[model samples]
Structures are given as structure tokens and as C-alpha cells.
Target: MYTLILISTMTNLSEIRALVLPYYEDVALICAIITALPVLVGIILYLSKNHISKPSTPKDAEALVEYKKYFTEKELEKLEVPYVQRIENNIERDVIEEAADFLKSSEQVLIICGESGIGKTKLAIEISIKINESKELTGNFKFKGNCLFANLRHYKNPKDIEEKLNAKLSEKTVLIFDDYQYNMEVFNEIKNKALRRNSKLIITTRPIFVKALKEKIGEVSIRKIKLGRMDINGILKDLEDGDLKKVERISEGNPAIALLALDYIREDPDRNAKEVFQGIRTSKDFFDKIIKDFQKEYGEDFIEFLAEGELTGGVANIPQEYEKTMIEMEKSGHIAKHESKYHLTPDVLSEYLINREFFSGTILKHSFEELARADNGTYILEMLNSIMKIKDDREIYRKAAAKLLEIVDQLEPNAEQKKKRIKTGIMVYDGFGSLNLVTEKLKEFWTDYDILQDGKDLLDLGIFLIKISKPYEARKCLEKAEEIFSKNHDKVGISSTSHSLGIIYQQQGNYEEAVKKYNQSLEMKEELGDKSGIAITLYQLGNIHYSQGNYEEAVKKYNQSLEMNKKPGDKSGIAKTLHQLGMIHHDKGNYEEAVKKYNQSLEIKEELGDKSGIAITLHQLGNIHYSQGNYEEAVKKYNQSLKIKEELGDKSGIAKTLHQLDRIKKDMDRLKEKMGEENFEKAYQKIESNNK
Candidate 1:
């Protein structure tokens, strides 16, 4: 094409050359403009097309993203399960099954109740699924109805929840009325809707509310399936990867508590529920330990408040004394002290305590044959040794404690049962320290967490030991514990056990092992929607790195942990982790950083009156002063710590203060020697003046 153009140009030669040269420039410029036209047009079309076809975000997607910007997938999933996992084992199960049956029969308003976490919504889900499957099987071309689940907690109006459910129910004709525990108005509305639409209504609620409704509305036509003991097979299935004893021990014949048991045991098929019970018992005792410690600060008032039950229609504050007592207990952390009233954190904890005490032949509930050999009578005497120590118990408290102890002494503890018994014993003693005399009788089992013999028990008991400074023993206990959860079919248990093992490893010197265990724990936590647990593990992993002198690694771990912790309102744990981080900074000579950590810890301690923890920070501050050669200041801190230790009668704390005081003295002497008598006297005087 160039040659042809050149040839054409040459045709005009000679005289045409001058005309061609000027004309050629003009023609060439025109050609360049023409060539650029297609490219420019193509670029404009591409930009216009991009603008026209830009992706559009659906309203749901945008709203969902915005809602989730502050939450995690694990946290968001919580909104899906409206059931609290409470209620008696068989009662809850039967209710759910019956709810399904009634729904299948197109009965409207299947009422649900009998305590929190009763698997009400869970049963509703099951009922819905049953209906759905039956519809699919109906030889009908299409099932035009759909299933609806709505929680009353999220809505001020049951009508609104009904509206939402209706949108979905119209498609499947099955509606789940959850949180029916108190919202009778909403319950009746759903009942009416179910009747009108010829749809099924599976109502989940507490019997108190149901009774109230029955009384008010005059016995509405609905199936009254009381949720009680879960199906035994279902219990085992939930504990599929766990043990029978665990289902037995933690569950205590109630499927409700068994759900939490899934948070602890890593069951092996070779091991039955009885074996997993070992894990459950340990977790129960561990939690009891925490509660009892809080109880000590607040007194037994909280326990009673917690045990007193939360069903307002059934129970109310008796008088000024009980109310005051409840407030005190709440302050001490035994109860969630909201609005100056108390409720057990959840019904599950109460049931765990009650069932573990009375029904099943757990060590706590066992007949003490070994003691009876000496004299079962003497064992009751021994049990009273501790029961006599608790402050401000009404007759009911003493009677309850004594009876529970009598049961404990009479039973023969299998290794697993023995471990649980020992754990409960330790918890009792620890909770009511005035009962140290009783601890001596149970001394053989004091450190017998090891004797419990399960992977989860060993690991968790090991972590507990670390806090109390029984490192060598803790290490030994955790040593027997496995790294990964047993490849048991109980997937839920596996995750919890894995997390326990990770925590143990983290406490030990093996950081790599710790990380590995933590990762496994994290995976399990994620699968289970346990954000609080995950955050705690992450923080712990960071601490492991900090211990190994990896500050950056520690910070990263802490940040990750904090992010998760904040979502769950785990303030106490968050404060503690921040304290560790401050230490890392202080060790690195980052005084500001260190101060930040201690300050955060200090704030929480102040709010909590965590005297024992406050002692630790005061001690740290003294060290920080000593590091800067401020001997007088160090001594002042040491004195402050000593004062607290004295107030609390904390032997270990007293020892710490003594150590700090000795160091301060030595530093003062060295400073005196370095400056010489005359100048040092002047320097000491200056220090004294500044200190004043």
C-alpha cells in the first residue's frame, strides 16, 4: 500500500513536485487524523459501555454488607438460631416432635415453652423440614408453600415477626413462632394467622407463658407438647463425636446442656457418652470454679439469685434483703447484674449444676461406698467441713450443700467420675476458701485433674493450673493430652477439644505446638460460630509469641483477638490480654506502650475490684520505676502492693511484694555507694522531696 501511494505520488513528478510537496503535507495530516478517528471512537464507546453496564448492587446485598461490616460470618450466623438451647432433655425433644406432627396435620399454633435454649426454634426447623419433605413426596407437581422462622427478641411487634414469617409462610404454609416464652400477644396473632391461612404454626416458648395464655385465652386449640429430655439417640447423635458419659455427665439427662458439652469433649467412638462425660464434668467444674470465684467476691447471694429462677410469673424479689443480696451478687460477677436484678447467665448453667448434683450418679451425686466402709456417716461429716464455711446461706443453702455432699461421699468414682468429683471438690473448696479444712480431706484429689484422664480434661485442667502457678504439674497434665482432637465422629466435640489442647500447648514452652493447636481451635471455633472462644485463642497465641520475644507477632495476635473479643463484649478477657501486651512493650523499653496496657488492665480492675489482678499491676509499676533507677518510687509501689496483699491475705502476693521491696533496698544502697556519702545524701534528699 505504501509503494502504491509512492507510485501515485511519482506520477505527478517534476513541475508537480512543488505542488505535491505542499499538498502532500496537507494530505498526510488529513490521513493521520482519519486514522485516529476509529481508535478515538472505539475508546469513547468502551468508556460509555462501561458506564452503562456498571454492576448494580441489590438493596439486600448493600444492606447486608453494611450490617455485616462490623460483624463476622460466625457472629451473623447467631441470628439464625433463635433457640437458646435450654429446656429439659425429653421435654424439649417431645415438644419439637409433636410440633412437627401437629404442623403436618395442619394444626395452627403449636405452643413452645419450658425454659431458654430448649431447641424450640430448632424443633420448629425440624418440623418445617418434615413438612417440606412430605410436600415434595406428595405426588403433587409443586408444593406452593414455604417455611418461615422468626424470633420475637429481634422484634418489638410480634405482628411484625408474623408479617415476615407470613411472607415466607405463604410460599410453604409452615411458620415457626420463636421466643414465644413471653410474647403471648404475638403467639395468639400467629395462632390466628395459622387458623386463617390454613397453615401450621409451631410455637416455641416457656410453659409459664403458655400457662398464662391458656388461662387468659381459655385453653386455645393447640398441641401442648412439653419439651423435656431429648431423644436418647438424638443426644448421642449430637454427641456423635463425643462420649456417652459426657452426654450423661454434662448433659445430665438434659439435651440442652449437652449442646455446651459439644464445646468441650472430643469424643471417640471407642469411648461412649460415659467417657465423654469425663470431658463434660471437667468443663462443668471449670465453669463452676469461675462462678464460685465470682461468688466469693459477691457472696452466695448471687448463686441463690441465679438458682432462684428467672420466670417472673413464678418468682419475684421477696424483700429488701434479697434484692440487696442479689445486687451484691451481680456486682461480684456471679450474676449478670442488669437493672439491679439477677438471672443466671443462662438456664443451662443452672441445669448443669442441678442435674450434676441430684439425678445422675456422677461423683457429685454418687453414693460414697468407699466412705461407707469407714462410715458413710463420717463422710457427711467431712462434707459439712466445707459447707459450714460459706457466708450468709439461708437454711436452704446449707441443706442443699449437705445433701449434695452426702451423695458425693457415697459413690464409687470411676476414673472419669473421680476426676469430676475431685474437680467439683476443688471448686467447692476454692469457692468457699474458708472451707480449706475440707480441701484437706479431698487433698488426694486436689491435683487429681490428671487422674481424670481425657485429652480435653488434661489440656483444660493444665490451663487452669498455669494461672495458679502449678506449671510443672500443668505441663505434665497437658503432656498426656493430645494435640488434635480425637478423630471421633463428634465433630463439635473435636473442635472444642482441639481448642483446649491448643490453649494447653500455648501455656507450655512449645510455641510452635501452641500455634498449631490454636489454628485447629480457630478452625473449630469458626465452624461452631464461637467468636468469643476464637478471639481468646488468638490472644493466647499472641501471648505465646510475646513469651518467645516476638513482639510484632504478639501485637498481631492481640489485635486479631481484640477484634473478635469486642464483638462478644468479652471485656474482662480483653483487658487481661491488653495487660500482657503492655508487659511486652515495657520489656522493650517502650514505656508509653507499657503504660497503655497497664492502664487498660487497671481500668477493668477498678470496675471489677479485681484486687488480685490489681496487685499484679502495682507490682509491674514498681519494677518499671526500679528500671528507671527511681528507688524511692519503687519502694512506694512496693508498699502499695504490700498493702493490698495484706488486705486480701494473699500469701503469694505478699511474697511478690517482699521480693520487690528487697530489690528496691538493694538499688538504694547501690545508688548511695555510687554517689558517695555526702553527694548521695544530697541526691537521696532530692529523691525524698520529689517523692513527697
Candidate 2:
């Protein structure tokens, strides 16, 4: 039996040991001595090979056949990454993260649902990348065969699904099904196959699919995530003023449409709103070009209609001659009508549709005049609402919107009017969609920034910039803002500035300054009955102390935050504070206490759907395994953390994993050397030098 095993296998140490153990007692001392030298020498040879051998890391990866079998040369080249590509995803960062957490730890099955253009594709990609990281980190990234990324709408039927899954389904692999909303039975049958075979199954769809699943498979069979539109805040903050204007001019906030719009902006950097709108259509036809396409379709009618409709009837109304063209345009997705009027579809679909009028509209000057002359607060609000919809010349909207706010505020004839204007201004601010407005407004606070108001504008701009993470500018803005607030006796603005400055310092690792600013903010909030503000400041102080390694002091500050009269979000803040305490315990080598604190944080994070926070805890738990010399378990935890990081595109966490992986490899080499290798010393030296 041993001989048969030996003939079939290159080497089976356990079989050899089993065969030899039975014969050891019968051997003569001289015979044993004579045989021992050769056996010892063979053991040394085997150990030496295991200890010194490296994994299949290629010199020029392009030469690697194994890699070529599964990936394109481009994929294998391991594209140079400068930093995490900043993706302003349409879906909320938190929702995607929560779904990812379940995908990493659960049974490799998930369903993500959202409306079209709501970022289902992005979320799927995020989850897949993360799982890929997990496979890579654990030294198990073999895809067995290939990866099949498909839009399920075109490919339905259980048989087709099986054929595709069989085409690539291996022991270790993942499949991403995008736009999988059209067929419910095909999806379930595919999911069932992956489950039976124990492989990863990811499905992306619109919300309609969830209903189909519920009706066909019953509640017990459905496990899914629902997605929403791009938060205006996320979109705005992601773009610079120039890009923000471009996005507004093109996509608005729809992820798919936004991409289409961005491409056009790249091609025609100088195109105006009317010119852009002219080209914005989804159908690929004569109407695709801005100036010529629509003209060919509608002839002189399209032009005379635009001249009469936009120039004469005002944007609030449309001319009668273009009414039929407008319906056709709407059906083709060239023009969008919301409240009995026409506006250009977002920039994404603009290339497919033509809106030469919208693309050519004089946005910077003329758009502002139309807005200013528009009737009461409600009418102005309606016009402001249309700013994001118009797309293609966003700077026009920003300057115009800011001016309108200033103009309306100045015209405040009574107390009620002032309140209405302020409310309308905030609506415009929020509706302009994102941080570019805040950043633009705050530009007046720059070294050479010029705004007529000496201090009020700067103070408001400072607060706005702080919310958007423009720290460098925030500091300058806030400093001037504080001086102005002090001059005008604006106690509220002063307090706010103090609070914001403290957060800036704390984030930069300046604990001393952070604490000082918090103290002043705390005093002001207290006098003003700002209980919520007090709690938030206390929490910031706690984080600063924690970063400085002051565990006890952090706990004290956290307790103060807890003592204040705050709201639901504060509960998550408290959980974070507890998490910081867990780290301190983990660092101090109190494994049990650390685990307890971590478990507590995990519960809160789960409840809160805080995926980033959960990933952090997973990373911390991995340390416990390394501390105990349980390398396999340690690698497992690290792999789990890597999966979450990948889904979230958390770059810092990826870097940390790479740094720690060197240790795991070295440890494995050391164990092999200790077995019997005479060249163990040389192997250790090679690994050490390689690490350096």
C-alpha cells in the first residue's frame, strides 16, 4: 500500500512515516545507524527545498502561462495605482458597505436592487473587488477557469445560467450578474447551483426584480439590498467647481447619465448650456449631434420653435409649434418634462439626444437675469430647482444662485420676508447639489478672495467648507470668519468657528490645539443651550485624546458626550468611543477585554449599518491571532478585513495588509527550515533581506 502510494505521489511524508513506524522496533542498532545517515540527509534536502522555495512570482509577469490562462496581459500587469481612485458613487457609501459585510461573511449569496442609474453596477464591482482581495490575501486566488460578467436581461433561462456557471465555476471564484432584473426563475436557479457547489453568487438588479422574487420564490428565498439615488452632497463634494459645473450641465445626479455627460464635456470643453442640451439625447439617431442632427429631423421647424419657445416664451413656457416635437423628444429622452414644461435630459443621455438650444443658452448672464426677474420666493425657488436639471454650464448656476441669495436677502422688506428668503436660499444651496457651491462661496475667504461683505459671507463660507473637508481653506476662512463674527457681535458664528477649528486640529493629530478649541466651543454651546452641540464637541475631544494614546482621558471625555442631551446619531458616536477603548485594551495585551469591547462595537455597527466601522474591528481582531502565533487564523481574519476594505475601496487598509503579509510568509519559511534543513540560516537571511 505504501509503495503504491509512493508510486502515485511525488512525496507523501505521512505515508512514509506510517510505513516506517511499524519497522522501527525490529531493526538492529548497527543497521539503524547505517540507515539513519541517508534518511537524515534526505530529510535535510526536503526541508531545505521547502524553506528556500518562493511562490510562483514571475520576473516578467507577461511570461507567466498560469496568469495568461485566466487574465489578459493588461490585467496581469497589475496596473500602477497612485491612490484610491476617488469614485463619487450614486449609492450611499453606507448602504453598499452593509451589503458588502454580509457578502464577505455570509454564505456567498446576495441580491442588490435599485432603480436604473442608481449605482447597482458600482456596488457589484465594489463587492467583487473586495472578495478578490480576500482570495489574494489568503493565497487562494485561483479562479479555476474564468470570470463571467454579464447583463442578465439578455441572458435568461436556467439552462443558459448553468452553461455560463459551468463555463467558469471552480473551487474558488466569483460571478457578478449585472442588470439581473428581467428573469426571476433564472436568477434563483443560478443562485441554487452556486449554493450547491459552494461558490460566490452576486446579483444586481432594479427594484422591480425584488417584487418578482417575492412573488415567485416566497419571502424565505429572498435576500437582497435596495439602493437609492446619488446624494446631492456626495456628488457635489466629489467635483471641483469646474467639474461640478460640468456635471450639472450634463448628468445631474444619475450615475449612468453622468458618465455620458462627462465624455461630452471632455470632448467639448467650451460648449455652452444650449449647445450641450442640443446634443443631449439617449437614442442614437439624427438627433445625436447638437447643431445638425435635430435640424435634419425637424428642418426649419426645430429652429423657429427654439427661437419662439426659449427666447420668446421664456423657459417657464414652451411655444405651440414645438409641442409635438417636444413629445417626440421626450419619448426619445432628449427632453425631459417634469411640471408641464421642457428641460434637457441630464448630460449622460445628451449625446444620444440633441438640445442645441439648451447647450447654447447663455447661462452665466442670461440665466441669472431670468432667475432674478422671476416672481415671488416660490417662483425663484422653482427656477433654482431647475438649475441641476439644465446641466452643462454649472458655474453659471453657482454664481447666479449665490447672487440670487444675496439679492433676495438684501431685499428683505420685513421679518417674514427675511425668513422666507433665508429658507429659499438654503433650498437653492441644497438644490445646487453638492459641495462645489460651498467651496465656491467660501472662495471669497481665500488670501486674495474678494467679496463685498467684510465678514458675514466669510463666516458662512467657512462653516460650509468645514462640512465638506476643505480643511486648508477652512482654516483661513474660519480665521477671517471669526474676526468678522467678533466685530459684528455674532456670538453664534464665533461658537461655531471654535467648534469647527477644534475638529480640524484633532483630525491633523494636534491634540493640544484640538482640546483648546473644544473647550471654547463647549463654553459657548453651554451658554446658548446647545446641548447637541456640546455632546458632539465632547466626542471630538475624546477622539483627540484617543489618538494621542490617552485611553483614560478619552473615556472621560466620551462619558461627558454621553451625559449631554443628544440624538440618535450620537449613539453611533458613543459606539465609536467604545471602539477606541477596545483598541487601547488590545494594545495593552488584554485580549479578553479587547474582544468584549470589540463585540460591543460590532453589535452597534451592525445595527447602524456602519460597514467601515465593522471593517476596522475585523482588522483589530486579526491582531489577536498574530499575537497567539496562530498564523492560519490570523491570515483568515486579515483576509476577512481585506474583503471589506476591497468592497469599500479602502486603500489605507489594503496597504496595511500588504505590510503585514511579509511577516506571514517569513514565518512559514522559518517553520519549514526548523524541520531539518541545514541551510535554514541562509533561507532566513534571504527572507529578511527581501523584506527590507
Candidate 3:
């Protein structure tokens, strides 16, 4: 119609132009839409590919929202158990009240000691709240956030926060220094200032810190409160219907473990409580989560630093850059700051880091060498030897031992420090796994060291002989040491000699003599309050019982040792005890229980990267399968064991696994032949029946 109008009206130029313009405009609009379709389609595809679903928010976190301004509520919640104003007749509550009362007393510092997850931080928080609400001091008391929980290192400017702290020292500020175990300079500075300002300094840390604090600050009358587990009956009643008793036993009275169990029960409601409790202890994933958080907050390098320091008996100088991090770690309960050095909190965490790839042979050797160069480095050398004994990493120990030997040899010959370090290394030759090297070093330096001048030298020589598998020589040296210790009235030395002699008797299969000597050692250790020595003697006794097939008695001794081991986070001891338990179960035809215990031991071994330990566990598992008539599974497990043994250069282990594989093959062949005979019999019977 527009065309007709334009054609009809020669003078209708405006109409024609208008129609053309409209047509062009419509075409342009269509072109624009076509172009946009591809772009729109691409954007849609891109969004679909890259999209991530949002995580569901935690409802439990809502309860913590009010304290968000003072802390990262989520982080604080992780650091401590949920707050409780009062638990009737609770031991932890009593400790809190005592600590709070101490804060109001003339005491300048209050030290609270307990194992991790025992509600130390929670107790501190409650005390702070109580003190703050009551205006316990001059002005309205201000509760500073948990010092250990604060990441002062990550702060944009730490000086500003420090200045604010200094400015508020005149006020009724309750500075809660949770888990202070290292950086004595900072601790001393803060302690002095807090005392000068009359501000309350409340500290919560591992029991080891009490010893460390005493070492750092000298004998100050700081009121010490040791937090124990809450009463079991009340906890059971409070938890309502659940395996609270099992939780109590497995968690060993740890509030954190109980809380975690409650969380699991609330989540599934049907999962076995005992199993859930065990999962918390044995699950690698749970440990990984805690370790990841520690690493994220303080960084892996700082963790490495702490681990190396611990290997040296918690002796290390905190770098200026790490000062804030150290404080934050202490506050967070990941580490403890006592004076100038730092120690990791929850000994298990230290064990985890020690077994990590970050603590490689090279790194360990470097740390050892660094300590060897420091003043009183001999103490660190002794500590290294002790750690190496627990680790049993032959290659790692060899490298470190050689380096230490070299360092001591090069030291001003005849120097007391040099002799002391050499003696320390010699005392732990069994741990070093370098009998020939240590022997050579010993011979080369013997005369120069004049080791016979001191009674302790005989102890070192005796330990070296024992490690070298020369029981006869060990007996002679230990007897000499005993004589010297007796003459010198060194009760501790005599006890040590008795322990060394016990090891010799054990090696010689003289169980009676071994037990007698170990008992002597145990009695002395108990008298000296040396829990570690007592644990070692008890474990040795368990070994004797296991060898004699007295499984029940062995378990009793092992359990006692295990309880003591728990205090120090002795993973090696735990794994050894578990492995022994697996052996007992296997001997008793408890295949399922044996498998569980073996798997648990294997997990810890794998974490420690103890290839020999892993192979041993695998072999035991194969034995269990073989007993159960699972030939194929037995073969698989045997092969896995063989592979690891071969990699470890364990000739005896490889040979043992090979023999097992041969046995399995023969068993398989016999099984097939028996099956064939049975099938023939069935065929014959079928034919006879048909014929009839």
C-alpha cells in the first residue's frame, strides 16, 4: 500500500521517503536482534559452565552472631567449647572460679594448665566475662579478646593495636593471654607492664607451660589452676540418651571430643556413638581439617619453625616478623610461648607436623646443625636423639647423626661442650641406626674426650653397646655404670643403668631378668616423678608379656603405658601399642578386631611414612585374610607388603612376604584340585541316579 501510494503520487515525495525510512528502520532492528542472539547464547553457556552453588549457611553460627564484633565468631567457636555459665559441681567450672578469684587477689598472673580441648580457653572466656560484668577492678573492666585467638600478624597495623593496648593499660582492661609458652621477651614485657598497670593477666596453656613459665619468670607465686575433665555422671545426665559413657572413656574426658560426638549424634541420630567417637580419634580427615586451619592462620613455614623448635626441646629465638604470629598461635592454642622459645600445643599436632613432608631429612639436618652451633646446643642434641628414637627413620637419623658427630668432632677438641654432645649422641646410638659410624667416632674420640673421667661416660658407652646389638659388651658397660652411680650416690643414674640392663636382658630372651631390671627402673622413675621414664619401663614390661603369650597381662601393661603416652602425644608409642594389640587379637582368631586394630596402626604408620611399619601391618592383614580363607585378598595384601618392603630395602621383610606368597600359591593349587574331585563325585552320582 505504501508503494502504491508512492507510485500514485509523483508529488508525494514525503510519503515515499517516510515509507523507505520505516522499512530501513525495521530491517536495522531485525539485524540488531540477530547479532545479539549469538552473544546472549555465549553468555548463557559461560554462566552455566562456571557457576558454583552457594553453600548452606550454618545455623549454629547464628547463636554466635552477637560476639562477631569482638571475634570471628566461627573461629572463636572452633577455639573453645560452647560457653556455659555454670555446670553444677563441674571441675572445670571450679578451676574457672578459682582462677577468677585469683585474678581478684594479689596475684599478678594466674596460670591454667590442661590438655587441649579441656575447655581452657572457654574457662578463660567465662572468667573474663565474670570479671568484666562485676567491674572487678577500679574502672568498668574491659574484656580484651582472647590474645591467643587474635591473629596480630595479619592485622594491617599491629603497632596501632599494641599502642591501644598500652593506652588502655591504665584502664580496667583484662588482658587474657591464652596459651603463652614462647617469646619470653614479649611475655616478660607484657607481664611487667600488666603488673605495673595492675591489669589482670590470665594465662591458659598446656601443663608443660607451667614448667616453662617457672623456668622463664623464676619462682613467682603465680596461682596455678589445673583443669581436669568434667564429672562423667553430670555429663551423661546432661547429654540425655546416648553413649556418653563410651564417649567419656574414648575421649578421655575431653570436652571437645564430647561436643564433637554430640554434633555427630545430632546430625545422624542413628550412627553408633562409640564408632563416631573412634572416628574423631582415627579419622585422618578430621586431623587434616585442624592442621589446615592451623596452617591457614599461621602459614606452613611457621609450623615448620615450631616443629623444628620442638625437636630441640622447644628452644628457639622468635624472629621479629614472627612475633605477632607466635602470639596469635599461642592465643589460638596451636602453640605455647614460654619466655623466648615456643612449643606446639596438643602434642599430637606436633607429631603430625614432624611426619609431614615439610620436615624432610634436609630440613631436619639443617635444624640440628643450627642447634648444634648454638650455646648449650648439647641439650638440643640430646633431644634430637630422643626424637630420633621415637621416629626410627633410619636414613633421616643417619644423616642427622653423622652431621652431629661431625660437628662435635670439629668443636675445639677436648672442650666440655664437644664431649657432652658426643656423649649425648653416643647415648642414643640405637636410635641412630649407624652402629659402625658411631663406633668409629667413639673410638676415634675416646681418648681425647677422656670420657672415663665421669660416671656418665659409662652410661653413654653402655647405651652405645646396646644399640650395636652387643648385649655382652652392654652388660659390662652398664655394670660399670651401675657401680659408679652407686659409689656416687646418683639415684637417677643407677635407675638409668637398670633400664639399660633391662633392654639387654630382653634382647637375650631372659624375660625374668628383664622384668626385674625394668621394675627397678620403674620404681626409681616413679620416685623421681619421671612419668616418661615410667611409661618406657611399662612399655618394655608389656613387650616381655607379649613375648610370653600373656596377652591379657600385656594389654594391662600397654594400657597403662598408653595412658602415660597420651600426655606427651607419643604417636610412636600409641602405634606400637595398637600394633601389639592387633597381634594379640590375631593370635586369638579375632580376625575382625585384628583387622581394625591393624588398619588403625597402619594409618598412623602411613602418616609417619614408616614403610617398614606399613609393610608389617600389611603382612598381618594378609595373615588375617589367609586365616579367613580369602586367598585372593591374601595375595593382594601380601604383594602390597612385598612392594613396600622391597622399596624399604627390608630384605627380611621381603623374604617373609615371598614365602607367604609361595604358601598362598600352593594353597590355591590344592583348593583347585579339591574342587575338581568334588565336581567328579557329583557327576558320578548324577549318572548313577539317572541309570537307576
**What C-alpha lDDT do the candidate models reach, one value each?**
0.52, 0.53, 0.60
Models sorted by TM-score, best on top: 3, 1, 2
Best by TM-score: 3
TM-score of 1: 0.40
| Each model's total of backbone clashes | 49, 30, 12
Q: Residue-wise lDDT of candidate 1 within 378-430, one digit each (tens)? A: 33333333233222112223334544444554557666446655555545544
Residue 416's lDDT in candidate 3: 79
| Tens digits of lDDT, candidate 2, 372-439 | 54554434554455443433322344554676565565553555444445344445544543333433
Residue 401's lDDT within candidate 3 is 59
- Judging by lDDT against the true structure, name the best candidate: 3
RMSD of each: 32.9, 26.7, 23.6
lDDT of 3 by residue, 1-692 (tens): 00000000001122224324655676576567658786575655555468623222211221111122334445465644446533422323555547546644666556666655666666655555554455342233333332222212122232324554565454433454322332334445556655555454556666644555656545456666666556555554676534665565456556666666666666776767556755565345334544554555567777667666776668477788888987666653457555666666534343354334223432234554566667645555645543553443323344455666666655655467556655655654545333455645544343333345566777777676665466776687788789889998898999899999999999999989999999999998889988777777888899899999898999999889989988877777778778888998999998889899998888777555566677888899999988887666677778778877765556777799889877866775575577787774564454333222
Q: RMSD in angstroms, candidate 3?
A: 23.6
